[model samples]
Target: MSHDENNAVLFGSGDEAPSNHSHNPHFNELVDARRRQILAGGAALGVLGFLGVGLPGESQAGERHLPPFGRRNRLPFTAVAVGRADGISVPAGYRATPFIPWGTPITGGYPAFLEDASNSAQDQAEQIGMHHDGMHFFPIDAQYGAGLNSRHGLLVLNHEYIDAPLLHPNGPTVVDGKRVSAEQVRKEINAHGVSVVEIRRDVRGEWQVQPSARNRRITAATPMQMSGPARGHALLRTRYSPEGTASRGTQNNCASGFTPWGTYVTCEENWAGYFASRDSDLPRELKRYGLRSSSRFGWDTLSGDEFERFDATRKGADARADYRNEPNHFGWIVEIDPFDPDSVPVKRSALGRFAHEGLVFAKPRAGKPVVCYSGDDAQNEYIYKYVSRGKYRPGRSDGRLLDDGVLYAARFNADGSGDWLALDLQDAAFQQACAAAGVSFADQGEVLINTRLAADIAGATKMDRPEWGAVHPDSNEVYFTLTNNSARTTADAANPRVKNAYGHIIRWREERRDNSGVRFAWDLFLLAGPESDSRGPNGQALGADNMLASPDGLWFDEDGRLWIQTDMSGSQLASGPFGNNQMLVADPHTGDMKRFLVGPLGAEITGITATPDFRTLFINVQHPGEGSTANNLLSTWPDGPGKRPRSATVIITREDRKRLL
Candidate 1:
């Protein structure tokens, strides 16, 4: 899912639709030390405790107290078994209702959906786009109190990308080396972006979308500003913005993040291949990000202002006259003020861009700098953290706060310890290392533009496709999913499995239990595989009960329950007992995991968020019936027979209306 669009994972990267990972050396020693620690009854050796954390009733920074995370968020539901159902499977007493599907109108300007799939590009702009992904709900101030109506909130979610085969009337029609239909191209263009619509629960507790002026769509053509060190760099100048201050569109938005001040962060993952660069002397960063000779969608093959923009090659005299720098504007964390749909999305450049899996904040202190943790969603990629230079006041604006921050790449040492190396080009060690690698770092912007290269220069640990990250709501401890890497030829102590196919979870504690720290301790939380391979001392797998693979979408509910979602490929779904990708509940405190819901065929269960009351939960089903064509459909879920399989969001709740465990 991280490398290519057609092969695997979910609709794109990051497991869930709107969703959103590494290790390092000290190699054999780290492994030997961990093994010794485990044998000495230190299997619980991960950096877990928070020495600086203050308990409830004590003077504290915020309303919540993270009382040693994992042990607190336990669930009481029974774990479901694997199944090969053609439709999604949920536990008894829990009902899953189809909430919103692709093409649903969110604004007054949008037209009703057409089952024949003949919606216009203009129509999609006003309607809900395809492939719903990571999302968050921001309750308005008036309805913010508990026991109040929890439905009147802005529902913000990512439309990852379209399912091409089903999107077009008869698939994409190609003619004369180009798409024969201009309207189809327009439809596809409008289909990719973020959707913010207002939803409300009625007196009967039924959630429904209502038309409002606030309903808006931020698409691939919308204008966006660049915010950090890379904002006005020479490499970012393009025909659209000669000063390199801004760019258009926010594509490949996978996972999402919500700020304490009420802004939504939409991350761009796997955005490189969407552009085409034909220059012979393209920058190393451009080629490394996978800007190719032609885009997979081939939108560049068509002619017109809208279509030609997809071609990022240098066709004019210089960067100012061409679109060569267009791709550079992407691969960032785009922050949108969901409450203000008319507001412009800002590309927070301080967060060094890679295949941005998602963005989640480290727990904040009353007057301390805000911290962010993210993973580069690719095989053997590195994880990153951004510590803002400015302190975030509880009521101060959260937007633009990410503009000035120190981006750090992680380096794991052998003895369960790690360091966050600064990706600063001015650092003497960085300068020497860059010189040795035959790379030149002229300024801080260059380091951010060439983040992957900078990380290499910094000796960061490579991970097995790090995906979504979930920070404990109370503790701020981080948990990242190292989604499997089948390309590994040799196994390392940190990445235990050779030809690692099943993936695992890695958790780390910040130094002194503070979010803003340069050092930390780490450990492997779970080695995901078949049930047999995950067995324990008594020959039984899991002290609780769960067998899964490629852990992708993850989130920590208010009550501290860690939700684990699977992202088995369409081909990999049948390879083991881990049937079609599903959602599982995990107890970080006890390391107990249980299966919750299993999705339909050819789909990945992703994008989950809950209402404040926890009585309503939302999860997205991406690319269901993926390989099926119009004539030979694979599934009929959420809809009756004879309809195209759609990427949709499912609302799950207890039959008794109890809070989600």
Candidate 2:
């Protein structure tokens, strides 16, 4: 989710600004070596197909290797035209039913949704959270080879953030300069985390909320434990958990990942804006993260420990005496076991925190180290990968494997090759770089605590706001969305457009097909924008059927079809030919792309997943009337005329009940 139009202005653009003092070369200056290599490969290589040229006398063997990735069954549905309709739009034969809107109740006596937004804090805790972002559907009968079961499962999703005006009946209440209603504040807090709801398809083919103990809500006020290398670090110490073993909750969870062992990973993005500090000289940890004297929300202005914790001022003599270290508790990837409602969510800090847009694990192999990828989601930030020290075992549901790992930052070079700089004290290169930068780490824990600083010392490539990542199911290649960076003034091969507003997607093949390898080959998969400005992987402008901007949510289904969703900002959506934020499908092999669905007015199309059988598809429509104020409403989505707009997930399926693709 892009927060630039929201409260992001409160925090200056220093974090989002370009890095003028970095030691690394301009990230986009790719050399001609890759072009030469592609030309030498003739028509056999996938690179040639991506380049959209065919060589004369192409061998039969070339045809076998032509697809950039493994072949997936071509998308069977007709393309949906771009539109600004105030409701869901899908292909002709598909039915998109709005399910589980913002206030839907699934647990705790099942409180019915009240249209006037009078739900209490406790009621909000038991219902679905607002602004759904990333999600996954866990099948109920996976043990019996029914992983593809379309009938029953748990739907787990992250509620990125809430719009205060749309959340309350008449917006938030203010007395003088402080928030006067603690209940409203509590409700807002309750709506800012992850939700695990049990859903099942009935005989009539409609998915319904199932009443079960597994249905749970992990809110911002929920109790959680801290784990990994930085678990007991002094930086994590606070009044809430003096030993640094626990944290309160997760916030700004933008995207997610699911473990092979049936667990969910929710990433904390833009979480720094929630904290405030009065200290004139803030620590680098807080300052680099954009923490100001005033937070995005005035939760600190209210009384009580829960609300006061938002203020990270150094009022007390020690960290334990105040909530100064509270902000550190967030910004880590939180692991949750949705099937076990009694389990406590753990903040896995070993992944190395920044604005973690999402975490996408590579294909896990038994007896091999677990590897995963994440993007920082801030201008000039870098992409990261974590290689677990412990070998991954099939069906091991523990997240502790993520605790002991070497977190690496990517450095994309000009020759289409990249190195993963280890952010470890044990690495000689890291030590030398740290010495040159006049920075030293007290211990490995400190290095993990200050991950962004460690990456800087190691000289990682500055990216154009890397976001959601997806690993190709067959090729094992990794792709990440470089969602626009308006502050960027210089263009390079990796990021070719100055003030890149449309954004682009980049993918790479790891060295020797090993996810833990330190080196890789990369290229721009697609540049997202209007047909006039954007270019597809084939070096041609995007056609009418597939024009897009701000590529955000991304996924590859079991069949290897790449599902791309957009998150165009208000300014871009209004000015560009792209009618609204949309979801598109693309063939990784042939580069054939088409628009799948277009969202309602002022909404972002994100959080997509499907039944194992590919018979049902689920996507989220977030913040329909995004810029709506207390007195003005721009759209009423999922509900008609005069109704309050609510963020909800839409379940799409073929009208004939056939497989989606």
Candidate 3:
């Protein structure tokens, strides 16, 4: 999420006042305690010999090798220089083509994009939404070629949030500080969900949207189902779903993941800002997520039940009679089957959500319990993992497996070791810890509902705003990006820097390399910052070729290369050592890193994926011209001069049409 003035309120993770005030042990204290114990011969090994600088057994020699592109583990392309440009920059032999901008028609009467931003709310439902984020490619040829044929597939991506001024012709209509135009508010709501569009490569080797039945848009008004342990709970009961078995829509989706069963899971991030409550005594669920008197967008200021649902206040006699429970219906990982156009999205509540940044499943093995990780992208939040109760079967698995699982919050201990504290109500340790903290759960449903509070009681480590997570394709080691937390005044083993302006990446390996294990060994992969503050895997300061900050989006390609993307704030780009938000790929094994691309001014380079054959790469440039309003624009990207700036996805490939490393 961008930190421009306009986005500061929308992406409230960093700007908003933190709700967590837990008195958990600081990470630096834990590291000091572990070091003392090791030196006193009380411990067997010294995992934090030098504050867990790098992974154990890392090769110091050949760590800085810059061989030309030949081996799969080496970075192939020349590093792109850092600068603040008005467009994208790639290597010499690579071609970057802008594919789908904010408003391109794919379904529903095939409405064309209006240059004047006069498209109606109904038109937005039929067109692409704003601010494209996390995405994946589901090939249509999966049944035949192991889904490697990505030339023609469904390009499913998330629309994080809407730029209100750009969504309307002359900006939004307001009366006495409240939004008056119902259509404008409705259009913004429609642009806050997911887009599943059918895209195929043309004979000219250009990707284009195809008009197919599978090209569907699931927006804020789409009907969905509620599943998992918390489904039909009292906290989820609302007027729209009296039985509490369903929900309205998904919003503020940032990063996403796909299941082995061929389903897509979109994560809800910074969604609490969309809801408002005037009541002083708010429920813990709403209060913990930071719902306040006025919403960032005044959707509830309009006059209808549909718009009034955004006001999550207690007005009616009971929970089912009002929209007080509407906020609870959100914050969960929504599972959608793109292949089945008519399938209703299910909110898998067993995953235990709290401002979910993204969900990444570990490498799956048949007859093993399916495991996945999610970060609660907020200051001083905890990381969570879910392990299925039943073992996964390759061809027979589905979202039902997510309905029954053990959700655990991570507790990164001293000595570079960690434990997965189970949130289960029946677990003896969990029960005793809750009892000690004067916290008790009625059942598993309540435990999952108050996930953040439960994590605090479980003594989970306070992290520096955990965000997107990825699992190594071969080693199954999980890596998470702890984006910058400027509010931190104390250091800990997991978060070493106080007042951490630039973020860092943390990686861990489960016991015996088992994703379902309760213990793990962890280390700091990269301390992201300028050349002076940042440290690479070789325990050295980063060079000009790989300087970065606020590492947000992350992924491990099939070849085990770690692709890192940055989401630095607008102010950071103006005064920091790094010029623009960029993307870099690194060999986790050797610590060699290279800058691959740099985005335009005020744009965040996020949401990256590639064809299975490794020939093409797809990435999203969000909020180009970060602080742009209707009158004062900062950028006109993808489309040249005289055109309004629109966020879009860029498609890149090798010049010789060979595989892209």
Candidate 4:
């Protein structure tokens, strides 16, 4: 089946009152007229209210009644706020039930997690990983057999980072500013990567963790094979993988995607900043990829082969014999066949490089090519897509179908139309550009490994920290979050603002076509800011209710409900009047946005997913009061009082079984 069969369009022209035009002149005029009409109608309503005959809730004589777009309902259920010891607050109607917390046994064979527990790398894999982010649920069919619904399916989640202090029995001690133990380093390494746990609902409708045939954990030490255009490039070669065909582990798996064929696509984000590198010791090419001279976490100063090897800066005599391949292993989309417990994950090089935030696939058409969109997850990086050259075969659920594709980086133009620039090594321009950049590649393989260089040569627009993205169900329009960029980066035509602290959501529709088309029209949907900031020609504010800074996680539900979650630094959280970070729901058509839930103090509201029934929603509350040290705990959320803040996934459902949207 094609994507259109399962996806529904959420917004149409009727939903948008277009006055603020994007680069598209035609759309600008069309939207402007609608905005004027909306304003005029609003004014008429105000006048009628003054006369007292036609009140706010009442309609004029013979006029039809409009639905309540912004008014609050006496919702049958109330939202219960969940917090830790420091008192993390949530919305009033919802209660949070911890589904998976740090160190929970994932595989069922392990001993229960103890707060100060120290497990070997192998044992840790059987246990839940650290910092759970994006997660999703797959329901099992009864046809698969009894206990199937209760023990089948997978819960794939990302392990963003490790909490060093809590992971060890004692705090990670830096003796002379360098860690002294190899065991400490080993624990940290095991903490990063993705976890897949089997879960099921019992007769009572309560979900339970199960140790099943499909329960597994993939960590930073798991072996992964490279596929597609850049498979065996020289840049991927290291002592670990002499042929450049394989790499060890995946880190920073953030917001993710699942294939129509039922596989999981986990993204590698913020992977660059983890490696320790010094200016003098690193190669010029490596530095360009954001591995500047200094290490952000100071992990390299620690002892042990694992901790020291995490630093990409060279210390050995030969590049091929040392840690050179470490950088190459990361920054790619790692695909996992979740149903096949024994299958190895494959990193498709055809997708290109950079800090990937998430990947979303379009519904594949029978005769048309398959299209997938992704973000670079960094300030001033570019957006990209991979279009398969071969047509998608419907109902073909095999894994190998995703192996081949033509990668293209987007160039969104000011005129409202955009082009997808191909990054094919066979192209003459690409060959010439590669030669000029002092990079040698025999085929598309090398180009995929050095995708940033290729996009630079192609002149793709640099966006402000592009993060998570989702394609609208109905319109086939693509939307991506440009999470906040600090004052340091330069702003160009594509990114026209300076010091864009409060990020924005930009979206655009294809011109008379779907994802397979080479060209499309575009527009900026909403500029996120605080209410006190500024308003567009339409009454939409750049602030609080409407203004959300650092829009990270976004997903469109089966019912076409757009859910947005935010992630703000601690400094921004305390001073802003918006209270704390929150999740907002918006109707794309009417531009009706409302705050649904707020996170705890010093915590970021990340990763969100909804069940097909739209009855249960799962959200991750990550690192509450993150900046607090061992001696000082700012927010005791999820675990009030003596407990340290634990990153966890909260499951929410209406007690009455009503539709959440």
Candidate 5:
């Protein structure tokens, strides 16, 4: 996919504290008073309707056509106006605190963050990484804030990419076609992968990271194990992992998923852009995966073979000599056990490989296989799901079930119905389809390695740049953001707009509510745009309160409030009404949406999570002032003026310590 904006954490205390705790007594009192006011209004309206007069929201028959608010669904808040603010803006009753910015020291002996944007590679590795994206918080069985496991936890976050100029003293320098600084390249490499550090709240209720032995950085150079179908495949036979059972680092991590067993799954997105392959005969799998000439960052330009491995071109007589297979090692769902920094992150190949945005599991049922959903965040790509071959056993993190699974790609039919086409090589139809396309899929390994091609051959439906997918905490239904596909010339029934720059959300329920079921029903949930009433594919228009565009990050809080985030960059971000990639909340049933929070200029609101007690919320503001260059500075956020912009996480809480609706 071309350069674009995108999408993402955890908690503490082992005592199983009460899920409901209002730390801010005033905020609770205010919220309660607000609820009481609404109740009184409802009573007045009921009486008016009984007197043959109409209520404010009533239909002619004294009944509402749409679902009522808070029958476990509602957006009971005022929508904030869009603006080009240079900082974050939350709801009237909410307050925000900045925490864990890039290059913030997470390990010992790290230099203080240089406001001028000069930090060494080694120093960066010892600090919080740059471009924070998908993240999770794994509680360490201790309690600190709000007296409800509010403080102690491992905060595992992804550094999707870096601001090259800002990361180096004088920006990246390529002199006579050769990088002048290995330290610079190393810093860029060290700024990515995942950051696992301990975080807790203090007596003042402010969240902060407390460095410990568990604080570790997994960069692009970290060793990663390859498991599943493509574990030992010939295509993965690189010099480092000569046995083809391992690879180094995960790159371009975007969104993420977490397993009940406590491991975090970081998605590898836009990874193919890192490799350069000018040879047309370099195999279709490589070409199909978007490996073209002229790599981004050009990390391989740095001196010596240590940094040159980023270039995935053919070299030597066999695979053991060069990094051609390195690209194959990426694009798969990677699992990291945050609880154990010593545990090697694994590439679960059975999940199938693609531009994985996020891996979200359906509520795992007893005696049933664990199932999860993922979206290929690229133009015209397909949605996918994985079903473990082994049954899920509660309280077991080492399920081994992830080592074996069945991967299926979605085929969204026009009649509000869809099918999950099996992507297994053993499937007769898939075998014939691959054969028809002149592809050699001899085993499960090939199928998983070239999953997109398999999906294409199986006639799986192409989507409008499917981004992040999240399963509802209560409904067990899945929702994914199709983040604006500018490539479509003709409308597909599932994606109605020919050039859908303003994205829509598509949701589906599995047949019989079975996570592994093939058949399903789907409908457009929200049609995003600047218009007050934009109609979805189903001809349902969202009311004035929900105007938005390019929906990217999405998640459901424990109380079932759906949080919506946007990534409207390019011209849209600078001038569009959706303004500055705001975060909003939606009532899934009634279609009520309100802008809950807005990020700083040139930033994408992503990586969202909440405390189990719903007392606090965390969201990442990535690449703030992304429009700026090293010299042309655009945004200076978190700390105002004269400092280089850095991606950081924002902590929000209701004034009364109650859960945000």
Candidate 6:
């Protein structure tokens, strides 16, 4: 059957909600026009003839009316809610099953996950890490072909953070502000890393994790290579790797991306806070990068040299001997070839860093530079893009193709025009700025090591907590989730919202460069909030669709369906103003968004990916029913019936045997 016919049969056309007259007549008109356009497009696609779906009639004479939030269901598919009592929650009609949970064995004879399971640091490497976030499934075909039935392949997932308390038999404790137990610290270290698991579907169409030779885990102690402009820089010199040629491991692997050639790009964010340092003990360079100044979480107070190095203070003596190089090793995008278990992950310095979120690659076209977009993921950071020096060679499987590139920081102007400010340290403007700032750099290595400072000197536009990004399937437009910023940043023209507790999704379309255009047009696609409290077209209050705060994870399926996930705090969930953190699907062309699924209590729904056939969707439910103490558990979710909640990855598939797109 044709794709259009399938969509119509899956998602009926008459699922639109009833309209009600309320506020902002102009917004009402826009809503009506959008509905009309969707109906017309659906008919043009021949979706109306399939399944006997009827289209809404056109009328411009009625009174202004607004639809309730999440009332419209233009998309074809049903949400299926699933969880292990304390696991993630999905929509109805869907079943959620676990792929791999914490402490699950990978290889090397590690045993299955058991609460309070005792294991050494090396054994922990063989087990699954904590807090599974963004993930991608690369199907293995008979000959690596692109067919839906090709279900055997590798699943690459990022373990964002470790549950330090439960990871060890005893919690990570400190005596007199010093970590007393080395074993506890070691367990915490081993519990933070990435897991690559091999999965396959059986003859009955059930997905299961199968142990394979390719299955491996890259941990904190693993030796990694440094590449690009920042290789062998003075700042990277550490006693562990004195030559500055290598670093220990990748931490804070949050959201992630996949290369067209089949590699995993896991991002390291919030690594600075892991270290501890005092103002008087830090170097001038360390203080400049927001480290040593003040740490949000004081991990340095723990005892031993291992925990002390976590604090990037200049304690030992010389720069090489001291822990000065600690901060330099982090905050870069780490790339790993999932297929090769022994491959050393490369921290690509070409992608300028700052709280690096995941990196998304655009479809490579001939005569155009390979382009990738990334977000800084801080309260007032910036969105960045890297354009490769050479055109992307499709179907190439080598890992070296991503090593060389030109990084650019985005500057969104008020006139709907945006410019990609070049981040090359060799540029005349950059050199002059560096000299003026008294920041002397020997080469691009220094620039990348201190990328946040370089972007600052270049006067890049600071954004509001930029998160995961996705590329439009048909139009090539790029969309990113700008999660809320609570910092009291003044209202500027580009970001003209005050105390933006509720965030928005900012998107732009390139003018010419495929996805590498230096010039582009941009706009605020949607402002998330409850329908009764949002400002409409004329700046008046009106009901909006799919209102929620803090947009975090974003993904676009092969069918151009945009999935938006939320990461709301406990306070927001407790209040009746909104439902549990959920995922919403929208049609970008018509601005039609609907809430697809609501997660379990105290859980933030994140890290979503779809199967090749669009029949299965995978999402991560992190920290379910969090903030529940030993006495007052707000929720008894996946661990229902007297059990604690465990963060997990849920595979969602419809039970009716219909396609989910």
Best by lDDT: 3
Q: Please provide TM-scores, in order, for all candidate models, with all chains considered together.
A: 0.90, 0.93, 0.93, 0.82, 0.87, 0.83
Q: What is candidate 4's local distance difference test score?
A: 0.65
Tens-digit lDDT track for model 2 on 1-661?
A: 1333333333222233332245554455443335444324222123343322222221211232223444544876788888888988899999999999898997897888788888999999999999999999999876446476778998999999988877888777755446778999999999989999899998898999999999998999999998888888899889888898988989899989998777899999888878889999988778777777877677898889989899999988899989988988878999998878999999998998788899999998888888999999887788999999998888663688998989999997665667899999998999999999999899988888788889888999887788999998887788899888887676654455678888988887776444888877676778787787666655567888888999998899886778999998768777658888999997777767889999999999999889988889999999898877556888888887888889999999999999898
Q: Which lDDT value does model 3 have at 269?
A: 84
Please report, as a residue range, the 10-residue window in candidate 4 with the lowest summed lDDT.
10-19
Residue 497 CA displacement from its true place in model 1, Å = 1.9
What are the lDDT scores of the predictions, listed in order? 0.75, 0.82, 0.83, 0.65, 0.73, 0.66
Residue 250 shift from truth in candidate 2, angstroms:
0.7
Off by over 4 Å in 2: 1-26, 29-73, 143-146
For model 2 the local lDDT of residue 636 reads 86
- lDDT per residue as tens, model 5, 1-661: 1112100000011111111111211111222222332223223111121112221221222222233444553555567778788998876888988888998988768568987767788888788888899987766762222324656777788888877767876566665444567887888888989988888888887777786888889998898899987888998898787889988888788898788676788999878776666555777568778776656766665647667677778876988898888788889888988767788989999988788888888988767889999988877677998888788877653537787878998876543456788898777877887787787776899888988878877877767778988887766768889888775565443344557888878776676444677766565566677554355322345444556789999898765567888988888987755677888887665444678888899898899877667788888999999856567678989888877888998989888877766
Q: Candidate 4 — which residues are off by over 4 angstroms?
A: 1-93, 117-123, 141-152, 277-281, 293-308, 313-318, 397-399, 428-440, 488-498, 534-539, 542-547
How do the residues 145-205 of candidate 6 rate in per-residue lDDT, one tens digit apiece? 6535446777778877764434555444544334456766676677777888888878877
Candidate 6 overall Cα lDDT vs. reference?
A: 0.66
lDDT of candidate 6 at residue 115, scale 0 to 100 = 53
Q: What does candidate 1's lDDT look like per residue over 2-76, in tens digits? A: 222332321233232111121234232345545544323324322232222232222332122445544443567
Instruction: Give lDDT tens digits, candidate 4, residues 17-89.
Output: 1111112221112223233332342232111211112212212221322234354432222332222224434
Q: Is candidate 2 or candidate 4 better by TM-score?
A: 2
Off by over 4 Å in 1: 1-73, 142-149, 535-545
